[model samples]
Target: MSRIGKKAVPVPAGVTAEIAGQAVNVKGPKGALSFVVHDLVAVDQSAEGIAVKPRDETKLARSLWGMSRTMIANLVTGVSKGFERKLEINGVGYKAALNGKVLTLSLGYSHDVLFPVPEGIVIQVLGAKSDQIIVSGIDKQQVGQVAAEIREWRGPEPYKGKGVKYAEEKIFRKEGKKK
Candidate 1:
């Protein structure tokens, strides 16, 4: 019995969740989202909220129990409040700008790196130096994937610690060479 799976996910106000077959559809003020649950886990809704349980005591079923529950929770939260990922660009000439649906980055490259923004995701460039980017979307997976792709362009280096990094991320700075 997984602790997280055993707990019921409460449906918030102004949000509706429907469990149909192996899929769960969630709709809220922000947007609508759906998730197809695996057969290993059983999902049902009660007056209190949604409940998830493993079909059997098998190892695979138990492993997916908590994960399925968490995925459902993410759908609910995402439809209601959405998700956001913030990235900070560090370097002398590193910066970012949003042009319509395109995100242009300057990471000491010879030419500006143009990143085409995908649908359902909004990219906003902020900060006084225009080095901060905020990626927001109703889907958690898409938001995270887009953020990761952007970070891959110019990952933070261990030496100077200059590159793209999460707002809450801490880069380990290595000591300089002793002459």
Candidate 2:
């Protein structure tokens, strides 16, 4: 019933995948990652690539079937090509800079905000005024999490739309108060 679950995850060339018990491990040029499939779902690797099936016809099993398959696919793609998230800072004197393992953000606050970069993740400040921040990592979830944390520091306002926001994000502008 799950269209996505019915499809097998294709393993690209130059990537190595291993299935051991309920865990799936993948190694590629970018990095290596592993994931444990749920008991309700069954996973197997074949010439066509990885396959996922529900253990039973129960709702829970069906629900987990597609999710498990997608998770495995993400792991493969992540290790092969990795993931990236970009953030754009707006406002006067607002900028981002990376110092060693720490990220310094100036968002018009009294003091600069410091963010420590975690292992396995790289944060780069680009753009002419250092307003663009790019977060990249082999893990899709981690890369997104790090980008979200940075954006949370100074979210875009509805009025001026000033603050940190995703490069592709659009902020809805609100009309100013009229006397």
Candidate 3:
């Protein structure tokens, strides 16, 4: 038995769930989210919570059963509470700014790098430090993907530790060679 799949997902107040064909739709105060279940997985809704089950004991079905439950739970929670990620820029002269929907990043390049923000995702420049950035959205996957793309522009270097990184992430610094 899959522990995660067997667990019940609690339905918060004011949230409604509907099953239509192979799709499950959840609507809450914040927004609405929907997902389609695979053929080997089944979803059942009750007054207390929702349950996800696998049609067979095969390895693939077991894995999909657990993953489907978690994804559904995330969708329900995302539309209700949303998700956010914080990023910090390192190195001198490295900074970030938001102009409309574009993110202007100065990462020691001769010219500023402009990144267009995706729809439904909001980017905000926080604090006078000029290095802090906050990305927020109702979809968790999109928020994480955008953050990763921004970090890829200047991935942390082992020697100088110059790049964009998570606010609390730690990077190991290499020691300089003796002359």
Candidate 4:
């Protein structure tokens, strides 16, 4: 049995759920998200909430059942409440700004790097210093992928600790060799 799959997914009052063949469509105040049900996993709408069941007790099937249900639930919630990721610029002179739909980053480079923000993703600069960037979107995967790509532009250096990083991410500094 899958613990996560057994959990009931609560449906908000304004949200509407529809089952179309193997696809499930969830419509909420934010938007509508549809997902295809897997063969090993079965989804059913109940008066209380949505329930997911696995066809077999095998390890792979059980895991997939739970993960698929969780992913579907996340999609519903994301379309309703949305998701956001924050990245901090650690080095001096490193900053970010939004020019229309383009994100301009200055990561101690000779030239400022300007990247166009993808559709459905919003970029915002926090504080007057502009050292903080907030990426918000309805899709969790897209938001994370965008953040990762931005971070890759100027990944944190082990020696100088320069570049973009998550707010809670820790950087390990190496000790200098004795002269």
Query: Model 2 scores what on Cα lDDT?
Result: 0.95
For each candidate in turn, give its C-alpha RMSD to the true structure in angstroms. Answer: 0.8, 0.6, 1.2, 1.5
**Top lDDT: which candidate number?**
2
Instruction: Give the C-alpha lDDT of model 4.
Output: 0.86
lDDT of 3 by residue, 72-179 (tens): 898888878888999999899999999998999999889999999999899999878789999998888999999999999998887888899888788999987889
lDDT tens per residue, model 1, 1-179: 68998899999999999999999999999899999999988999999899999999999999999999999999999988999999999999999998888999999989999999999999999999999999999999999999999999999998998999999999998998998
Query: What stretches of model 2 exceed 4 Å from their correct place?
Result: none
Candidate that beats the other on lDDT, 1 or 3, i.e. the better one: 1
Query: Which residue runs of candidate 1 sit more than 4 Å off their true CA positions?
Result: none
Of the pair 2 and 4, which is ahead by lDDT?
2
- The sequence of per-residue lDDT tens digits that candidate 2 reaches over residues 57-115 is 99999999999999999999999999999999999999999999999999999999999
- Per-residue alpha-carbon lDDT of model 4 for 26-143, expressed as tens digits? 8888777788887887788899688888878777778888887887788778778988999999888899989999999998889999989999899999977899999998888889
In angstroms, the error of model 4 at 13 is 2.2
Model 3, which residues run further than 4 Å from truth?
A: none
lDDT of each: 0.95, 0.95, 0.89, 0.86
- Number of clashing pairs per prediction, in order: 0, 0, 0, 0
